[model samples]
Target: MSKIQFKAMVVTEINDKQFSREIVSRDVSTLPVGDILINVKYSSLNYKDALSSSGNKGVTKKYPHTPGIDAAGIVVESKNENFYPGDEVLVTGYDLGMNTSGGYGQYIQVPAAWVVKLPCNLSLKETMIYGTAGFTAALSIYKLIKGGVKPADGNILVTGATGGVGSVAVGLLHKLGYAVIAATGKPDAKEKLLKIGAKDIVLRNELDDKSGRMLLKENYAGVIDTVGGNILATAIKSTKYGGIVTCCGNVASPELLTSVYPFILRGITLYGIDSVMCPMDLRIKIWSLLANEWKLHDLEQNVEEVSLEGLNTKINLILQGKLMGRTIVNLDL
Candidate 1:
């Protein structure tokens, strides 16, 4: 085999308070030894990547680290019995993008335990388009279905609907024959949200107040929430009896200040979703669903592709909350 040096987006902390990311050269041999090696074709940007790249010790403690949480590519090498060279594979949300080298690079060497055989229904580009954000959205919808939520039960609310997780959730839910009410902070995205299948659109500020009492109007049968803090509490209070609420992000705040009345009186179910450490069995099942019945045809409609050199612009855009849908990073650039 020939030796190769590739470029990767690396984040390093120059001081305890300052951190920055830049595309830098890395040797293939420098990657952490693993059972499988992937020539990463594509990756997706996520809020967590922003956190890790900006020196959030909670997501990453080391410097000079790549921060992509989603990768989809073909296997170049493998030592494990389950995978082989030339097999198309994808790896997301293990330790691949945290402290270990991740998909922001041209390659990633990861344990075979982290690889998921790519489903034939989607291409590598399609997989990263869904990425961690879409996976989390699917998981939330899956949980809602298991909780017996149905299209006719009532309107389903999706908060942060212009974001990756929220946008995908809205698309998936709308495709499943449910009435989706999308809430967004961006006034410009209303037509985009409606075009993706949302039945209604509302400004996020409509739900801004977290001071409402234990229960509200019993409006929605379920809610897919990506913004936490006050918005989460507001969603909880407003859900109908027997409603299910799935929450997965803390872009707002992690705190939950609310009464137990929604759970105790209305029999509401609040599920905490964690995509990073989800069990392998469940992960496999969800991926299978994404490939088959639960597949959203409009998935490609929500993606915006960019080159590695264009990443910093996107990072700032996402932080400013000006970007919508998913931002797919093309590493070949």
Candidate 2:
């Protein structure tokens, strides 16, 4: 085919400390060289994408960049034999949406190794709905299971419950028969959380222990913590003996201030989740599980679809911790 032109969300630096996003037409030739070129059908807004869009150098060192970490689409051209034109695929993590031009565009050129065939029972749109957040949630649950935390162990506490990762974690854990306790700052979300399979809801402040005590009442068998800092430390401290806690994000704060009493005395295990560089084998396994047994029946209830023009608002809301659930971007719109 001749040169392909498509629309994309571009973030450009305006001044010494200012930035702006605009939807502009881009040619496929402008995309970075890769073995596979995909006609992106759907993309998703993520915390990293927001940071990149706002000129967070830590997330994106350069400007005039696209900020979408999660994408699902069909392969349009491939130098790698593993992919062919019209092959449906999805990509997340790696350097995507970070230093690399990511999924915010109508097209993305990525290494074939970064792509995975869309699993049966999942459509491109549905896959984007899961996005990186849902994938991280699944990875957290996988670690918890590998660490021997079972449904019978006790209640699993999910912090940042209304947020993307936390909501998906709650739903997945509950679907697997685990009792889930969702903690969120929004009290009005109680009914929503309960409907999504949370056995109960606790105000986020309840987990932010202020007491200097090295430990608190041991309650949770496993904790899926999407927020960091005091909340993570509190979860570590409050975990029952031999419990496991998987931490994925540091939205609250990157710092973890706590003693080793939780680790040694309580035999608690803390697993740091890194979905970006997850091995291909594990990634495929997780996606397969997500498409199959762990699929959320109420996915639509937790998902909102938006066009590229509407992404900026959602990005700002996510940075402020005001957005809940997932937002998928439809390139066609």
Candidate 3:
């Protein structure tokens, strides 16, 4: 067969004043050097993808680049004998959608080290449905559980509960039989959070409007925090004795300002969750759990499928905190 070309979303810098993204056609030869080439079926829209699309230099250092942190599909070409054509796989993080052109295309040439064989119980669409965001949530909950969190250990708190990470955390925590307290700035999301398994809804203002008294009344057993900042600090201070808090994002701000009172007095454990460079062994374990034990009750309820062309609007929606649940980008469509 002759060379097959595919469409990709490419970002271009327009002078110093503007940047633009457009669909461009290119052959597989244009991809960055790698051992495996994939025929992408699905990719998901993440906050980082939105940042890269809108010219966030920290997430994406270059223009004329494709941005997608998570992708699932079938192997079309492989130099490594470990993988052959037609084998299913998925790739997330580890410089993907960063300096490297990522899965916002019909094809992706990626380092074999960054790829994972799709678990047998999950399909291409189902894998992307969990995506990087869901994986991070799973990792967070895993750490909390490993640190001794349990269903009867009071209620678990999920901050930014309407976003992808928090939404998955709430669902998973609830599935594990924990009372979940969801926190969100949008009051309109209360009903949505409840449907997703939050037993209680705490307004953002109610949590962040504290007096910074070094510590507060013991409130939660554990917390899944995506919007780091005061919310994280507040949650830490309010956690019960021996409680764990897993923080994974800086959507609000990166700076963490809190005293050692919670740690010293309550023996609280603060865990930092990173999905990008997670160890392969742990990543496999988490993926297994996501596919089996920790599976959500309504995995498809919060999903909103969008085409590649629809990304421009959804990107803005995610950045504005107007979107809830997961937004899976249907690259094949």
Model 1, range 2-44, lDDT digits (tens) per residue?
Answer: 2669889999889989988888998889899898889999999
Tell me the spans in candidate 1 whose CA falls farther than 4 Å from its real position.
none
Cα RMSD to the true fold for all candidates: 1.2, 0.8, 1.2
User: Where does candidate 2 stray beyond 4 Å?
Assistant: none
lDDT scores for all predictions? 0.90, 0.93, 0.90
| Residue range 1-333, candidate 2, lDDT tens digits | 349999999999999699999999999899998999999999998898899999999999988899899999999999999899999999999998898889999999998899999999899988888899999999999999999998998999999999989989999999999999999999999999999999999999999998999999999999999999999899899999999999999999999999999999999999999999999999999999999999987788999999999999999999998998999999999
Structure candidate 3, residue pairs in collision: 11-64
lDDT for model 3, please. Answer: 0.90
The number of the candidate with the highest TM-score is: 2
Best by lDDT: 2
Candidate 2 lDDT score at position 259: 99
Task: Give the Cα error of residue 91 in candidate 2, in Å.
Answer: 0.4
Q: Predictions ranked by lDDT, top down? A: 2, 1, 3
List model 3 lDDT by residue over 200-291, tens digit each: 99999888846959999999999999999999999998999999999999998898999989999999999999999998888888988887
